[model samples]
Target: MEKQELFKIGDVAKMFHISVGSLRHYEKFGLLKPEYTDQETGYRYYSTRQFECLNTIRYLRVLDMPLDQIAEFLRNRDVKKIQEMLQQQKKRVVMKQNELQIIEKKIENRLQQLQDTLSSELDTVRIIQTGPRRITWIRNKLRPKSYLDLETSIRQLEKQQENTVVFPGKVGIGITKERLLKKQYETYDIVFLVLDQEDNYNGIVEELPNETSVAIRFCGSHADAPVYYAKLANFILAHKLTITGFSKEITMIDYGITNDITKFVTEIQIPVAAI
Candidate 1:
């Protein structure tokens, strides 16, 4: 019988479409090994016999199975055991696929929000009817002094609500009627996450019902919120629309959407009189 060809590390990596370091990583984790190694030079080599094992390792990795799991599967080499491992990996893959779908839907929603905000007339107030929405939120009466503190609190809220909000969650905040009336633009009392109606989540869920609202979608960072709030207040007064609820500030296009402060859209909505 003819001897099968032996491949060097670089050649094996190319054949596997993986980096050399990855092969080294696999070997370090004991998930795979070269068929032969030179004792004196310490050079590794792979042969046809190792090819099937290497391919199996690669397949398991693509399914996101941990190295330890793969190593255990390889060491056992039992049909039932390997089948059980593969079944668990299949469940993980399906979960990831479902997560990706959720993420895609979130992207679509953000894009639609951006399109709608950009198309609307800047600084113009409009009275529009909005349907009911449920939100899971964290409220802080005293706003933080620094961005770091604010971010830390936000992170804590997310951690607390990790299982409460679905993947790719949308965050928003609310300013009180007193604040808008007093021009306390930077002071936000409540921070909330917008929840889909069908989302079965646990947390402080608040239902905002349908109402005619005086809303102004403005483009800029939160620093510009005060000015837009004033604009919205003026529009409400001019149209004889009485403020009916705590002003809701929806971050239509927030820091999550873009890095440009000018592109961030803050929609100030205040439920108004039906007339």
Candidate 2:
């Protein structure tokens, strides 16, 4: 009788430079099945043909494919099916890549702020008589994490605003009347949407009455916000403007979750009278 050629688990592991224990675990997980088991010693023997299968399994697993999916692919060995599954994985990876890119850009922005613009100018303030106009906005719970998730929400709000209101500006901005308060784990309610009140054409905004607001540009880290707020309070006092309604901040720039330091840029709005 001719002896059949076979490779022991250790030999295969050595060939692949993987530990024997890792191979045993993979077998236990149904990722690799031995060609035959010795009855007396209960030793597992793999066919040389299974080398490619093991390599493929490890590759797919590295791609973060679930164990069940990996088993299915190994069993079926269908190229088209594998390609389809890989395509779905690619999309998930791409979404993650976009998130990472946003984070990196934000880090760069913060670094620039830290080096050049954080505390050079004091008593820096601006006042603009924002004309009455129409805008479509979305109000929601906002916080540090919310900015990280801004793209999806911004896309949703933009679609909704375009569907519901006649907006002229090509830009989308978040506007709200909340007092930019920082409460740990507190729900931040702010509006995210399209603000185009200059154009006469309006579908939803035209329904509201005209009101005035005092606006200030805040270009600093979060620590600088209180100072800006104090300045806003001072501006109101100096101008003798009447405080009528809730003050708001229109988010023109967003540094989404690159880091958790003192870096945030927003346009602070204070509602005031013409006194």
Q: Which tens-of-lDDT digit does each residue in 75-189 have in candidate 1? A: 8889899889989888988988987887677668767766777787877788889898887667677443322334644664567444545332255567877666676777888
Best candidate (score: lDDT): 1
TM-score of each: 0.77, 0.43
Scored by lDDT, model 1 comes in at 0.73
Best by TM-score: 1
**lDDT value, residue 202 of candidate 2:** 30
Off by over 4 Å in 1: 1-5, 142-156, 163-171, 177-188, 196-202, 221-223, 226-231, 237-240, 251-264
RMSD of each: 4.0, 10.8
Off by over 4 Å in 2: 1-14, 17-22, 34-47, 98-232, 239-275
Clashing pairs in 1: none
Per-residue lDDT of candidate 2, residues 72-190 (tens digit): 88778887999998998899889889767756765564466454434434345555465554455555655433344445545655553323332211223322334422212223354
- All candidates' lDDT scores? 0.73, 0.58
